[model samples]
Target: MGNAEIIAGIKIPDSQMAKAVTELVRDTETDLLYNHSRRVFLFGAITGERKRLKYDPELLYVGTMFHDMGLFDSYASETERFEVDGANTARNFLKSYDIPERDVDDVWDSIALHTTPGIPQHKRPTVALVTAGVEMDVLGIAYHDFSDKEREEVCACHPRGLRFKHAILSAFCYGTIRKPGSTFGNVKADVLERMDPTYKRENFTEIIMGSAWDS
Candidate 1:
């Protein structure tokens, strides 16, 4: 078991299941995704610690590991959104270990809603933390929450490459493009918009502008 202080007193989980999932992700996804998944757990744990939120480190680690699994062909669905696919995969994986149904659902929700803003925060502590971690890594949504040293430590381990933003976008498209309809009501829809010129999504900005109450 390998553990490191991702933040002051917080250590990354390195149990057998953690190692197995890490290896599974590494073997299935590219370096960009492998590193991103690991960082998601680290960052989520950091936020959970900072907020003094009660959480299960091992379960959170599992959720984060499988959060993006749907992006790979092994788990991808031609109809369901990758998020749901990933969430279902996590649920199925944890069941194999006889994880309690309650905890399994927590991990499932964590992966399913990691991409949806504002809602995960209202779910289980682990789910909110998982969402926080993804937003932090992908969008720098709360980058300032961590100290310079903490940020650097995480970056050192995960090392967001020079083209990370673009790479993540490309990765999202790779997963969802084959099933573009899967992105219909979520942010993943933006990937289809960018990947396919003719694919237009419902635009909130336009909706607000055209609303009868405004302008």
Candidate 2:
């Protein structure tokens, strides 16, 4: 028999396989990352509540938990961006449970586009909330949306390591530098630039000008 998902210590209700997914995330990610993922979920759920958006909380939890799994060696790929890898992992996890394809797709989009700005918010509530949650944790975007008490509560539960920004940035670099080509045409390219000084992404203007159709 498969191991039962744990929930005694978790603050959130273990809906469906959310506890299992959360446990997997904690096991796979570094402490800093795991805490960050948990905080993202809190921030996102709060935002969803504030906006009065109707969404599946468990789906959001699953998406946020797996959002950064691509950074871990077991899940990271040389060809795909970390986001895609994470999305694929989340998708597969959901499929194994015989989840509805539409719900699975929502989780996939949420994990894949968590880093993307402007677009995810236009997507479904699940996707949009994931992006908002991630942005709140990493960039502190819309930080004011939640009160000090709310922020303190989440942070208290998932203490931020000292120098969290630097640590997370370094983690991002570590995942992308070895696979520099995968960083091109996306936000991950900037991470490659900061970490590997010798790395340079292709210029879109040059590509457009050099295209055969330009003549």
Candidate 3:
């Protein structure tokens, strides 16, 4: 019901759904995650603009906001990948609002595959941009691509805080430590290895050799 605020030349979606999502995330997630999510949306929108890709702003906003929800205690699922838990949470929330199946699927894919590197880049605009935003923010994958002004503005609105790298790593560790097996075959394995000395990674070759097939 209010004017949409523009960050880095991208308008934050001000729809009812957007407001509801913002409120829910702000209440449920830590300040770190809530701010990170907002930055992700802003960065992703900036990337989409640079790439000249057509995407739904509202869907992208939802995907970015919910992408890390799985890392929270309330949404974390036992035995499921954090990414999948987040995706499922977003999917359910969207369905409750009667979002179209295709749009919901895009948002779900965006969240589920945000942690996976190679594929999301080839998907639809929203899915691809979600990963783009995350990589830019966390991994610094395209850090220089965004100008100093752009980065400063986005971070000014949602400051990464004094120890974002350490804080985010700790967040990842805390979120997945309870379900260590869920970190296999993904980047979170590195997180666990770095944070938990007792954690051992699952080797793909060993798994293959240990399979039931006798050939």
Candidate with best lDDT: 3
Best by TM-score: 3
lDDT, candidate 1, equals 0.86
Q: Which is the winner by lDDT between candidate 2 and candidate 3?
A: 3
Cα lDDT listed for each candidate? 0.86, 0.85, 0.95
Which pairs clash (backbone N, Cα, C closer than 3 Å) in model 1? Answer: none
List, residue by residue over 1-215, the lDDT tens digit for candidate 3.
Answer: 25669888999998889999999999999999999999999999999999999999999999999999999889988899999999999998887787889999999999999999899999999999999999999999899999999999999999999999999999999999999999889999999999999999999999999999996
lDDT (tens digit, per residue) of candidate 2 on 1-215: 13433221224647558768977888899999999988888888888888989988888889888999998889988789899999999988887696889999999999988887889999998899999989998898999878888888788878887799889899899878778887777888887788788998889899889999947
**Per-model TM values vs. the true structure:** 0.89, 0.92, 0.97
- Give candidate 3 misplaced runs (Cα > 4 Å): none
Q: What TM value does model 2 have?
A: 0.92
Q: Give the TM-score of candidate 3.
A: 0.97
The residue ranges of model 1 lying beyond 4 angstroms of the native Cα positions read 1-9, 202-215
